[model samples]
Target: MIFRPIVPQELNAVLAQVRPDPSTAVSADTVRARLADGEYRHRWIWVAEPCPGRAPLAVAIWWGSPADAHPSNLDALFARSDPMWAFADLRRRTSSAPRPTTDPRSAVAAALLVAAHRVFAVDGLVPAPDYHLLLPSGWRDRPETAASVAWRRRAAEGAGLRLTAEQLRFERAADRPVPSLSNRLSFTPEPDDEIFVDLFRRCLSKSLDTTSTRKALRIGAEEHARDEIAFYRHGTRGRRSWWRIARTTAGQVVGFAIPSHNSVVPVVGYLGVLPEFRGRGFAAEILAEATRVLAAETRGGVIRAETNLSNHPVVAALELVGYRDRTRRLVFSAT
Candidate 1:
């Protein structure tokens, strides 16, 4: 087998061989653009050659952070390829200087861990003691495996890590009673400016409980705000773009939902209700309204969202509206 860096010319070939469908957002062109823009630093696109007469296989996409530059990111593009084998390949490429373990257990899991370690290594990155893998609802009820759990823990400990178990909660849409409210909240799409900023600040202030969680969520929200604004300002190439849905009541801005057509999935960039509007089910209402709009725009697809696991209210609100729990993203530090 041979491992080599992919060049711009080979991107289309890589996508053709690896990508599930030509319409996926993580295409060769998209990755190349990110690499060109310096977002994807210390990255390697690897293909595995078969022995003798077999066709070459696109094994994995390993991305690393420039700061740490650990060969960690490995996504098995070919279904026939074993993830563990790809992980071992990455391990061989990494320098043995007490480097953090790159996640190869699952697609992109080890990659993200390595990336975080690279960025926050100097700041003493702490792993979650034991990582929690959220299973789709009902996967836990029929479980019977100390051996399985032990194996997971052994893998982590062997890699100088630990593992734990926890239930991940998610919202799924179901026919439910909608609360009655007189606010008459409506969504109006517009550019994210001072008004949206203020709305975000207000919502975060009310929603986040702990000071640390608040601060972290605030930073994330701010960054997302900027990205949404940029996407709206300079529409993404080869994509449908939109910035609509502002929630207001009694001539006062309460909340808003920013939907864009940049990816294969229509993303809800930002959605929130001011502190003053809490308990009135405004958050759920706005999300439901956004879902309606998205359904109208697209035939049907999964709506992706991420929130700190600690935020119970937002999680509950999402459930109230009709989003399902997909996966729990475990973020770690290498330092």
Candidate 2:
């Protein structure tokens, strides 16, 4: 099979293969919309075909910030239900033994990713972009969710993207009563970005958040902190002024809260307390502040947020602030 990215001429044909699925956030319409916004590009969408101009047997779509030079996530993957037949046919024609596999489509998907990464790596991107699987809460016990995730999980691992983190997604209506913040702490916006970066650096020292911890390991804590700040500044629709650094009434630093928005809706983007301030009930305080900020802008809409499943304190804080569990996100990466 030949594996390569589709061209502009093949957009319609390639798009036809991006079918809708209840388990996934990706769809043909979503792909088209992101493509128009430059978040998805032709060069980042790869396909596997039996020959030139033939219909693709599999497709892999990647997503990134519009201002980014390389894609960050493998948004969706699609493959024919019975790809082994095609492989068997090709093997027979070449007088070779066919590889054995009960799940052929996953193999095809893995090969497609491996081939695509060679090109992407040459362009200075990482070996593999992360793959996000958004599943319903308690997905492990759901048959359909488990079945749908099985093949993709195999494909991701085969392509060198191993399961990295699992996080709980959450949402709360703006109309929900805002949790009260602690009077012992005060929130204020700092004009200089460096101060927030330093705060993030301090927060990362013993953070339980998987993504932040992984990034810190990969690129030092300070750099990771700066990268996060840059993401909020350029990659999201959130305003910088909305960020608040929390401090005690006596002016000792406690933590910070970032009430932000993605392309869609307001989010409790980020909140963290320093190691020294841990277990002081400051986490819930900052979370409440972030929720309050977001609720004001959403105007009776919903605010979304997420935290690592292993982060008990943050999870407790989220629950205390009235953000209900919405879904779970399983993230895979080559790291």
Candidate 3:
């Protein structure tokens, strides 16, 4: 079998081979747009072929930097592979399709997985064991669709990956009732990244991101905090505004909040309290302050936030501030 990056000229042909459900195929226009779009690093789209000149068996595409890319919804762009001696195909086809026929998707998917990991290593990208799979809100009810997703999940596990956590997205509208402030904590315009780094490090004692990072990559918590400082700094795509530091009346540090705009939508980038200051409701206050800061700028608009499912406190705090549940995403990892 021959596996390699699909050439631009052959993109349309390879895309034609991807027999996805209606409305899921990547259009030619979309491909062109991504090529022209500079914000994201559109890594190479890979394809696998059976033999010297046979048609492709599967394809895989991911978003983000090559080494650390996340799977978009269409990650399963698998090319049908021949029936294999594997239980994955047997188990996945149970509910999704008629058992009388062969399921080539799994065969193609397994090949693509091996190829993808090899390319990831060759390209010097940060290694992640698994790619995230997005299961829509009503996935379980749709038996056929859910079956296909389950098949992909099994294929992922076959490649030594496992389901991790659901990253829940939450949103608060500008109309959320803001707590009246007596200025008990002072908010400052902005400060150096180093200052935020120290506070973030302090918060890492029980941080979900830190825990996940440790489990996934075996990195220390301090390394995770520094990476977070870089992330919050670069993740803001719109106008860079005040990244506030909240302090007490006596000028002691209370917490920090990042209120910024990503493109047109205002966002609560990051809000955290010192580990020693937990249980006093500092998270909600910082969240509310950040919400107010963004809300004032965006009338009746929304402030978006995402927290890992494991972080119950962050989710509770978001709910306290009128942040409704928007959506949930499953994060899968493998090595």
Model 3: number of clashes? 8
Candidate 3: which stretches are off by over 4 Å? 17-32, 39-42, 51-55, 65-104, 141-145, 174-183, 209-217, 260-266, 296-301
Alpha-carbon lDDT, every model: 0.46, 0.85, 0.62
Residues 1-335 of candidate 1: C-alpha lDDT, one tens digit per residue: 34344556656655565543311125556566656644343235544443323333433454433333343322223323345565565456544222334333332233323333344345553331223333344433435333223333333344344323233444333233334333477666564465655555556654653322333464576764554444444443212233444456557777776554433355444567777777766767776666656555654346555556676766776776666686553322111
TM-score of 1: 0.52
Model 2, C-alpha of 264: deviation from truth (Å): 1.5
* Model 2, residue pairs in steric clash: none
Q: Write the per-residue lDDT of candidate 3 for residues 1-335, one digit (tens) a residue.
A: 55577766776677666565421344445455554543223445777665545566666665442223443222334545454533244335333222222355654565566566666766664453445554545556878767766656655554445645667778777776777535677888665778887887776666665334554255665676787677566654533465788888898898898776654377787788887778877788788888887877665377788778778888888888888777666666652
Error of 2 at 66 (Å): 1.1
**Worst 10 contiguous positions by lDDT, candidate 3:** 93-102
Best by lDDT: 2
Better of 1 and 2 by TM-score: 2
Q: Which should have the higher TM-score, number 1 or number 3?
A: 3
| lDDT of residue 231 for candidate 1 | 45
Candidate 1: which stretches are off by over 4 Å?
1-95, 99-135, 138-183, 192-194, 209-224, 231-248, 301-306, 332-335
